[model samples]
Target chain A: TQLLEQSPQFLSIQEGENLTVYCNSSSVFSSLQWYRQEPGEGPVLLVTVVTGGEVKKLKRLTFQFGDARKDSSLHITAAQTGDTGLYLCAGGRGKIIFGKGTRLHILP
Target chain B: GAGVSQSPSNKVTEKGKDVELRCDPISGHTALYWYRQSLGQGLEFLIYFQGNSAPDKSGLPSDRFSAERTGGSVSTLTIQRTQQEDSAVYLCASSPRGGGLTITEAFFGQGTRLTVV
Candidate 1:
């Protein structure tokens, strides 16, 4: 079975602090997607990384794809209270395999 | 709909009862997917429909779970004899095209929360 394992199941940091979440897999993926979900709502796509060793930035959030396409990471710089949410990583090909996710809380 | 839409935002059913969840994909989307998210867990893919044809149903947990799409627009998922373990958020998503040779982003709908008691 294809599985994406995420680290640091839960994180709580003060405002202005930085954090990083990781998604790792044994199988290679064609693409990797990052999503953030608020309570009672579905996940909102944050970014997609298709190329190996690629890095993309959106505001304070940065996403990196591993050179082998078997892992990815999300780094949040100077997190704010609004950044508190469930963050998920999905590896996609014909179907998507999701990681358990990182539940982050940015205390202000 | 401008985005994928799911019906009955929340449902509470007794064990052994059956329930149906619906999904309306965005217009022009050809690939639809069903997923389940348990508390504090990741999304689990359940099924995939490509323009009214299901090319992959391997993620379905059991025979009691079945889904179908009609006219390449809306899809329905039926869960027979609901169990307490089945309680979760059922999510639906749609993509522009099937991920056969290339990958595409999927737009998701606010999921339906099912509670079996």
Candidate 2:
């Protein structure tokens, strides 16, 4: 089975702080996706990185795919309370296999 | 684009009762999927539907869980004899295509949170 492991299961940060969450696996993936979900709602897609060593940015959020396609990271700079949510990383076939999410709380 | 949509934002039921969840995918989407998000288990894939055909049912935890898509747009997941362990958010997603079986970015719906007592 392909498994994706996320680190620091939970994180609490104050506004304006910067933080990074990780997703690692022993298996390589063709594509990896990052999602953020608020309480009581489904996850919303953030970005998809297909190639190794690829980097994509959305405003204050930065996503990086590993050189081996076996890991990925999400970095949020100058974080705000609105950034608080459960962050998930899904690997393998870009279809199934979502990692145990990193639950984030940004305090105002 | 209308996005994906699910019905009955929340469901509460007694043990042993059966329940069905619905999903209306985005127009022209050819791929549909079902997933579960429980407290400890995180997100678990349940099934996948391509048009009216299901090529993967590998994720269903038990035979009690079943799903189907008809007319190439709407899908339903039925869970029989509910149990407390089944309480979780049932999520539905759709993608335009997966040309080589590797999916693209999926659009999700507001999941139906099921609470089995």
Maximum-DockQ candidate: 1
Q: Residues A2-94, candidate 2: write the lDDT tens digits.
A: 999998799999999999999999998888999888887778889989999999999999999999989999999999999998999986563
The count of residue-pair clashes in candidate 1 stands at 0
Q: Once superposed on the true structure, which residue ranges of model 2 sit more than 4 Å away at CA?
A: B99-102
Q: What lDDT would each prediction earn against the true structure?
A: 0.91, 0.89
> B8-112 in candidate 1: lDDT tens per residue?
899999999999999999999999999999987889999988899998899999999999999999999999999999999999999999866446778899999
lDDT of 1 at A75: 96
Model 1 scores a C-alpha lDDT of: 0.91
What's model 2's TM-score? 0.94
Tell me what TM-score chain A of model 1 achieves.
0.97
Residue B106 CA displacement from its true place in model 2, Å: 0.9
Q: Model 1 clash pairs?
A: none
Each candidate structure's TM-score, on Cα atoms with residue i matched to residue i, is 0.97, 0.94
